[model samples]
Target: MTNAHELGLPERVPAGDDLPAEVTVWEVGPRDGLQNESSVVPVEVKLEFIDRLADAGLTTIEATSFVHPKWVPQLADAEPLLAGLTRRAGVRYPVLVPNERGLDRALAAGVEHIAIFASATETFANRNLNRTLDEQFAMFEPVVSRAVAEGLDVRGYVSMCFGDPWEGVVDRAAVVAVGRRLLDLGCSQLSLGDTIGVATAGQVGALLDDFAAAGTPTSALAVHFHDTYGQALTNTLAALRHGVSTVDSSAGGLGGCPFAGSATGNLATEDLVWLLEGLGVRTGVDLDRLADTSVWLAGELGRPSPSRVVAALRG
Candidate 1:
């Protein structure tokens, strides 16, 4: 288990003398964070938000989702949002696609990178997707095939990979089985999400090690955590020790799973950037700039930020 102190963060830097050989952080605040806000942020505001994120040195940002407006009304202007996006050469903008219809819309928007999500648990799948586990797999099979055919890079997100609130606990076997399928289905990378955010570092470590022992390559896997129990960075360090290089975070800790009651915002991008920069890991991100972005976003949403880093910096 990662030390509880790591799980509970304060405004102090750790001495990581021997850092991982390489690490990558994906910023998802624009899409994942803002999508849940009740205030309607306009497409122009979203575009500028993304632009500021890019300028803050985050190379990868989830732009928006192509889901039905009824499901996520916050992102209803996805089309215009994409149209207004000022594409930087090196930055890759990935949009989330719920199903075929979602992917179709994304294609029309001329997106090159796409993300699809599915649950590792059967009950969660039924609840989250309104479909059975097998049915979810069936949906991804075609999405992956057609997406690749369109020359789009697809990233798969396996939600509730570690645990499920509804089911009480998630089986590692279930995660591995679904993970292998997603990889085989042509997903270039798979991000394991603690959707309800109940993962512990020890559990996260053991799971990665188990996958390694099973002859699965762990390099293509990423960790997407929520700070529900203040464990995201702790789990991140543990995953890094296990050679898991990619991590997903949100600016200002802005995100929550609407389906799960206690799920809160994701690990703060500022916090992650500070930790990694101190560790001598080059995330190519500007911490001060990211802090400003988070603060601006909180004001835009007319709410307080969930990120401790932002609060500390604001002072």
Candidate 2:
């Protein structure tokens, strides 16, 4: 598939159209990116990375996960990180919580926003969470309820929304069912994740159409894509054309899904910024600074970033 840049598309797609003029980038580098790395990054480095992201004008950043250290040891210091963080006005820091216990830790850390993850496929649910789909929802009920009661903004993540490694070609209806359940549980927004990076533009459009038909507004949805097959930017454009305003990406294409061995790093925030700028979409992010941040992070990771934009800039 040809990318938007390759097609020589116009800079601006005219206002008052189906596409939105502005987009919100939910940066997940500090959490999702680092969790998958083999080496454990220090708390100070993690804090600095997050600070740099906010400094680059990323408004929403996923700081870390509250899951047990047994599962994600890298982010075990979620509490300390939150406590030491320099909170900024109009900037949101969200943490991932697996259960009520995780929620408690997050609340104690003064986390104002949290995210819960679920799977659209049974295989992934069992492998990733060790629970059946129904059992997982049962586990999330009280967690979501408690978080909402505490006035915390809850975001739900539905993984393997398009195709699963174990089970191929997931039905659109199945994805919508899980998404609706999350919204029913009082989740303020749901992020649809292409965990294996197997989605095409047509598949993305069809799934969004199903969600819209099921009464889930596009405004309450965010799209997370992996660039394993080199389609992340194209898929994101498809989502934007369908009126999705929020996108979940990682700086420098930093991480991949540990559960899905075949997966690669996520859509690069720098690349997304490049595309959005060319399309005249406002993201409030400085593309050059964001790329420089990625380069610095890559040095800390002891490797080069996988982001195309970053590589080009370095050249």
Candidate 3:
């Protein structure tokens, strides 16, 4: 078999530093990816898409969200969809819950893990969640606390950590503060998002450095990057160099932030896997199978996948 670097892949960066041997990819295609679609995906299609992702060796998949149907009608089948899922022994399916009500619905659906989302920017917080920063925190406190108490693993998502569509150049310190608050709220991990896809590699390194300075362990952090400006892989490389192992990606590069109008899709899972495998980093994801799955999903969405790797491999 030909090695990845033999195909002209670049050498791993920051020359003497050791890259992580394995990275955990958190697949978000089902929830974040599909939520922004104009047409609602059928529940059966959503289920099969998730199954394909799992079969392709994704250990952690963000299946669906329990937010009110009014906000994301595309994911209104959260309950039934989750209920129909065939659980795998080592796989985790985490659902996004916006507030107490959402948490209630998720629990009733027998969700074992849940994620609460907040924003580093006030404008995004208001627009996305219809709550101010403080109110959003207040709203999530009990949800996180109660979920953790109930033996459900809780994850926190802090959106617009790098920049916001309405509020540009967010303060790194402010993003750190929100991240710390989420950690204090019993969240086991915090996923920092570049909601508007405005982050550069330098900014990503600096932000991770700041998080380290604030006593936030990189082990507890995951990076979610949008590919709008074509910097997602570059930014992911920077994060990996900084010891961040958990990455959020979508199959077929299928995602956009509905609230951030200018934003594009997420870093494609196949693309990320290609990069990681080329660098000799272990991701446990089958690239060819994942590409096939992306193609299948693109057919369902009635469009070609935005993933360059998927396109190239399928062609």
Q: After superposition, how far is residue 35 of candidate 2 from its true place, in Å?
A: 0.5
Q: Which stretches of model 2 miss by more than 4 angstroms?
A: 1-16
lDDT tens per residue, model 2, 142-237 = 999999999999999999999999999999999999999999999999999999999999999999999999998899999999998899999999
lDDT to native, each model: 0.85, 0.92, 0.91
TM-score of model 1 vs. true structure? 0.93
**In candidate 3, which residue ranges exceed 4 Å CA deviation?**
1-16
lDDT over C-alpha atoms for residue 56 of model 2 = 93
Q: Work out the TM-score per prediction.
A: 0.93, 0.95, 0.96
RMSD of each: 4.5, 3.7, 2.1
Between 1 and 2, whose TM-score is larger?
A: 2
Scored by lDDT, model 3 comes in at: 0.91
Query: Top lDDT: which candidate number?
Result: 2
Report clash pairs, candidate 2: none
* Per-residue lDDT of model 3, residues 144-221, tens digit only: 988988899999999999888787899999999999999988999999899889899999999999999999999999
**Candidate 3 lDDT trough over 10 residues, lowest sum:** 7-16
Query: 1-315, model 1: which lDDT tens digit per residue?
Result: 765235333334544544465677888888888887867788877888899999998889999988788878998999999988889999999999999999889999999999998889888789878989989989889999999999999999998988788787788888878888898999998899998788999889888877777677877799999988889989988888788888999999988776666678888898887777656677888777888888887888887777877777674
